[model samples]
Target: MAKTIFITGASRGFGRIWAEAFLERGDQVVVTSRKGSGLSELVEKYGSAVLPLELDITNRAACFSALEKAKSHFGRVDVVINNAAMGVVGMVEELGEQESRDIIEANLFGTLWITQAALPILRAQGSGHILQLSSALGVYTFPSVGIYSASKFAVEGFSEALSLETKDMGIHVTIVEPNGFSTDFTASTIQSKPLPAYDQVRTALYSNPAMTESDTYGDPKATAAAILKLVDATNPPLRLFLGKKALPLAKAVYQQRLASWEEWNTVAIEAHGL
Candidate 1:
């Protein structure tokens, strides 16, 4: 049984890796790139099994049209990977209007548009899975990555709600949270103009062991194998963490969160007046 996977941002990094994995296994894929860099190679290698589209997912109409074309070309999309997103490297106060807007537009809204476009097709078919590319930053945060993490946090919020909303429709939503990977993701992140006032703050964050990976960055190729198992599973999780660091980071973050919430529960309970 071959699956039809429609993935955005297939020009590089995790997208390219995953797309190749699918093609190697005889799965047909509809892969999109913003500037149209990665698609040609996929088509050259896989022939008609790869449908390449030039897409800027930030454009809402284009997203809908792309999805429609994929459905028309492939007849059905078994998996929709909303993996096209951008990151802005900035402290919250260091961010400018354009920097904040670009990150939010590409990461949050682009994801929303694609998810919206895919829903009807999945609904009609009564089966589908959506993989939302989020980050460990979505679960926690770092100072310099406030804007980037905010975008991921927003992604996590809606995706969790979406998982619940679509479960009965046979449409599964999974948020893919990857810790720091040895991909160009970090290098490619758009940098906001520096604020000298926050130099020490930024320095401290960058100096932390966790910031630069207490362990080495995870291998990007490993992710492709994980998702192969993921999409093939009958019961998949709503949240899946990639890389070795995510689980430990999540546990530490959640434990601290639980402790704080428990400590503050008295005020919360009193406010409810029950």
Candidate 2:
């Protein structure tokens, strides 16, 4: 059965590759981005099968309207990939208040809005998949990217709860955590603020000249393939970690946290009367 997938932020990066991958597999895809021109190109190449909707996911009305349009065009939305996100690279305090808010609105709240709007259609059909494009930072914290991490962390929590909530309802939610992918991410990523105090640390940690100049990370096509597998699987996992570096980092973080908890378990268990 050919699936109809609606993907936001489809103009570029993983979103664009995912859209193409699905199209190649004979699936009808609705590609959306904030700009119409980019979406127009995909529609031109893929024809009617690729429905392009120009939208900013931050707008609630636009989000719901897109869902309605998708339903009208395809009759059913088998999968919804909320891949639209903004990366803010800077210290939280250094970043302007409004900039931080905008990041949250686009990356966190925008995903929430789209998921909420799509629930009705998915529920009506009684089965659907929701894939969230999160980051490895969602699992672990790092300096110089606090704002971006914060948004992704919120998404991680939201997706976890949503997975449990929709599990029984036949709606599957998967969170994709990708590490440094060879995409336009680094070049296109925005810095909310540049603080002199953090310059050395930022240069040492966040500034990867190789990533900026060369495509040495995981392939977006491979990531798309993983997404396809998750979408098609009868029982997909709640979280899909992507890229070579992502899983290791996530594992290390989890282990460290587990050790910390275990180290204090005696006191914790005693307090709880274990």
Candidate 3:
């Protein structure tokens, strides 16, 4: 059965990859880009199979309006991919106040609005899947990318709750956590001014095997088939890690976290007043 998938940020990166995959498989797609640039090829090639929309996901009203227009054009929307978000590269103190806030605004609040916009439509149909593009940093953290990680962390939190809330409505929510990908993700991020004090910290990150290794990044094109299988599953996972890095990183992070929590159990129990 051909499905209609609505995707934000479909002009590039994983969004474009998945959008093309769906179109090639005879599925209808409603693709969005901020300036509406880079979408002409999709229209020219895919014809009516792709509906390109000029959208800013941060605008709540615009998000709702876009979903309505998609439903009107397609007659039904089966999948919604919230792949639009901003990335900021900075150490904790290096980030500007407005820069930190804007990253959160676009990554966390923007995703929230789009998910909110899709809920009503999906609920009405009683069958829909939502894919949120979170990050491996959402599950774990590093020094230089705190603000961006914080935004993704917030997204992971709310998206988990959203999955539970929508399960009864036959709506499936999948939070996609991708590690480093060779998709201009690192190159295209908004970088903050360098603080001389953190030079050593930056150098250490650059020198780390995990950060610099060739295998750390995965090909974005290879992900389309995995996502296609995911949405086709009868029971998909609430959390889907895109590359090999996320699971191993998550395991190490949680092990250390659990060890610390156990070590502090006495204090935690005392503070609980139980």
Candidate 4:
């Protein structure tokens, strides 16, 4: 059956690819981007099958308004993709208050606003799916991406709590953690003020094989396909990891965390029932 998908940040990168994939499969897509650059071509190609909206998702009011327009235009939104996000790369100290605020506003709160706005629509219909675009860094942080990772980490926690809370309402929520992908994401990333002392670490981070995978950015199309599969599944996992690099790294980080918790179990028990 055909469905309607509302995707934010659809002008480029993963969001654009997902929009195109849905359109190709005959699904109605409500696509929004800050400037609607990529959406223009999609509109030309898919015609009425796609609805392009100019959106700056960081604005809470704008987010609600855009979603309202989407629901009104499409009749109902079966799936909401909270894919609008901006990346910030820098040491924590290097990022000023405004820089931190900018990233948090676009990536974390943007997603929250969309999800909050979409929930009521889905509840009234009694069925819906929400896919949040997190990142591998959400589970495991990387140097220079502290703020970006923090935003994603916030999304992960919010999405998890949302999933648990909405299951009774016939609404599904999934957090998508994708690894490095072949997109303009790196080039488009916002950088914090540089510190001369941090240059060595920053340079090493940028030159790392994982970061230098510029030539081998994972295919967004493949990740999009996996996403569609998750959306269509009867019981999809709460968290979906995309790309080859994400799984092992996430597993390793989680394993290490678990070991530490176990190692400190005595301390935890000692504090309990105090």
Candidate 5:
């Protein structure tokens, strides 16, 4: 049976690819972005099965309105993909307070709002899937991407708790953590603060290499395919660490964190009076 999918940030990147993948597979898709123009083009190409919704997930009223519109169009959403996010790159201290707040609003609170709005409809249907597009930063924090990492980490924790809470409610929650992909993400990324101290490092890490070397990042199509596979599976994992770079990084982070915890376990136990 063809399922109804609602995806945010569908103007480009993983969201767009995921929308296309589902449409190809005969699924009904309602793709949304802050601007409707791009999504309109996609709908024009793909026809009615792909509905374009103009939405800014950061707005609570807009989020609810989108959900209502989706429900009206499809009756019920079989899957909800929360892929809308904004990346704030720079040192936490250097980034303006407003920038940090904006990142949280877009990446964390936006996801929460949409998920909350969709839950009731999903619950009424007895079964539904919620997929979150997190990142490798969700598990391992990096130097310049602190705010982005924090948002993703919040998403990781939220998804984990929600998965457990909805275990018996017939609603499935999954988080996809993908490494650097060949998307406009890096190019379109917004830098909250320009620290002169980090100029050389930033250029060396983000700019210079891209110009000298051929891009070897994972393909968005592959990521979309993986998403489709998981969505269609009989039993999907609660958390899926995607991409070649992502898997190893996640494993290493987990192992290192575990070792650190074990090293301090004696002290921890003593503190607890065990």
Candidate 6:
């Protein structure tokens, strides 16, 4: 069955690839970004099968209005893909207050607004799927992108909770954790003021040739196909990871946490009252 799909951050990266993939499969695709620059060719290629709108997910009212417009056009949205986000690179102390707040507003609050706006529509329809685009960093943190990881961490928790809450409502929620792809994410990422003291560590961490190397990046189209398969499943997982690196990284981090928890289990339990 062809679905009515709404995707954010469709101007580029995974969002653009997914939009094209869905439209190619004859699905109704409504895509949005802060600007319409990247959507023009999609509209031309797919004609009425795609609707491109300018959306800034950080604005609650704008999110609501975009969804309303989509509903008005397609009757109802069958799937909502929350893929809009930005990354900021800097150490905790090196990052300014405003930079941290801005990234949080765009990545965390933007996702929240879109999810909130779509919930009522899905509930009223009695069936829908909401796919959240998180990152492997969401499951585990790394240096130089502390704020970005924090934002995705919040997304991971929110999406997991939403999945549990909406499980019986005929609405499905899945958090997607993707590894490095051939996107210009690093180049486009916001950078905080550089500190000389941290320059050596920063270069060592971020300047590695394999970090953002395009030759080894995962395929966006394959990832998009995986997402499509997830939505079509009779019982989808609460969390879906894309790219080979995602699961290994997540599992390793989870195992480390578990090990520490068990090591201190007796002491940790003693602090709690029965």
Alpha carbon lDDT of each predicted model: 0.91, 0.87, 0.92, 0.88, 0.86, 0.88
Q: Which candidate should be chosen as best, given TM-score against the real structure?
A: 3
lDDT of 4 by residue, 183-203 (tens): 878655887889999999988
TM-score of 3: 0.98
What is the TM-score of candidate 6? 0.94
**In model 1, how large is the Cα lDDT of residue 204?**
92
Write candidate 3's Cα lDDT for 55-173 as tens digits.
Answer: 99889999999999999999989999999888898899899988888888789998999999999999999999999999899999998889999999999999999988888999999
Candidate 3 wrongly placed segments (more than 4 Å): none
* Candidate 1, lDDT over the whole model: 0.91
Off by over 4 Å in 5: 199-216
TM-score order, best first, reads 3, 1, 4, 6, 5, 2
Alpha-carbon deviation at 238 in model 1, angstroms: 0.3
lDDT by residue for model 1 over 90-143, one digit each (tens)? 788888998798889999999999999999999999999999999988989878
lDDT, candidate 4, residue 22? 91
Report the lDDT of model 4 for residue 140: 95
Better of 5 and 6 by lDDT: 6
Candidate 2: segments with Cα more than 4 A from true spot: 206-216, 266-274
Among these predicted structures, which one has the highest lDDT? Answer: 3
lDDT string for model 2 (1-274, tens) is 9999999999888989999999988999999988765677777788989999989899999999999999999999999999988877777668888778898999999999999999999998899999998988888878778889989999999899998898888999998888777788764467765778878887777466634645447777777778888999999888877877767667888999999999998999899974
lDDT for model 2: 0.87
Candidate 6 lDDT over 79-164, as tens digits, reads 99999888888888899998799889988999999999999999999999999888888888777888999999999999889988
- Candidate 6 residues lying further than 4 Å off, grouped into runs, are 207-216
Clashing pairs in 5: none
Better of 1 and 5 by lDDT: 1
lDDT per residue, candidate 5, 1-274, as tens digits? Answer: 9999999999889988889889988999999988785787777777989878889899998998899899999888999999988887897667888878888999999999999989989999889999998988898876689889999999999989999999888999999888777888764467775878887767776664533445447777888778888998877898887777777756788999999999999999999974
